[model samples]
Target: MPHTPGSYTTSDLSRKSGDIIAEALRHPVTITQRNKPRLVLLNIEDYDRLMRQSDARSAMTLETMPDELFGEFETAVGAYADSDEAGR
Candidate 1:
């Protein structure tokens, strides 16, 4: 089940903070204040995994690119097509 931060008040955590940290170690703890989620405490492994996935997604978005260094891609494609037709 997803951890519910609202289930425990700040006082509950402050009084038994070690238990809270231990629980967070097992899974992320969604910490809330004033009934809104304010923080997520995750173990190191999970945080690292999330960061790696974000980096991979950013890399994938940069892979496909136009050939021209200074002009629109349509101009590049049209130039290529015109050259091919002339050669034929």
Candidate 2:
């Protein structure tokens, strides 16, 4: 299912909770309080998909990197550490 961002007030949500949740299955719904956005309603699948994407983006294994590239990385880290110490 495809979804677009939609905003709703708390009172509005309270009155139409079921419908709102149904809509959330298709897209994220922003809950507002005092006319300001506060919380989001979304399907569990959407939540899981987002978490998976985050994990994929953060997946890094230095051990899998080429030796030459990793060597340069080590050198860069050493340089950065030296610079940080100098700044202290």
Candidate 3:
């Protein structure tokens, strides 16, 4: 389901636990107390998806990339140095 997580105060959570949890199962829900966000509620599948994405990002390494990609990366870097935004 497509959903954008919405904030829920502690009081709100306590008053609407079922609805809040059901919403959280569809998308992450922000839990707040005293106007400060304290926690996130997400379903297991979504949590696992986040973990997998994080793991993939953490495991990235340019050194392990193919030679063609490395060469293209180098070319892009050189182009950056040649561009007007290098100093900025």
- How many residue pairs of model 2 clash at the backbone? 0
- Candidate 3: list runs displaced more than 4 Å: 1-5, 55-88
Tens-digit per-residue lDDT, 1-88, candidate 1: 2335534455566787888788778888766666667777778999988998785432312236544533565677899999999999
Per-model TM values vs. the true structure: 0.53, 0.56, 0.54
Give per-residue lDDT, candidate 2, residue 24: 88
Worst 10 residues of 2 by lDDT: 1-10
Q: Residue 26 error for model 2, in Å?
A: 0.8
- Candidate 2 has an lDDT of 0.84
Question: What lDDT tens digits, residue by residue, belong to model 3 across residues 41-72?
Answer: 99999998888878443344797988997899
- What is the full ranking by TM-score, best candidate first? 2, 3, 1
The residue pairs in collision within model 2 are: none
List per-prediction Cα lDDT, in the order shown.
0.68, 0.84, 0.82
Worst 10 residues of 1 by lDDT: 55-64
lDDT of 1: 0.68
* TM-score, model 3 to reference: 0.54
Alpha carbon deviation, residue 45, candidate 1 (Å): 0.4
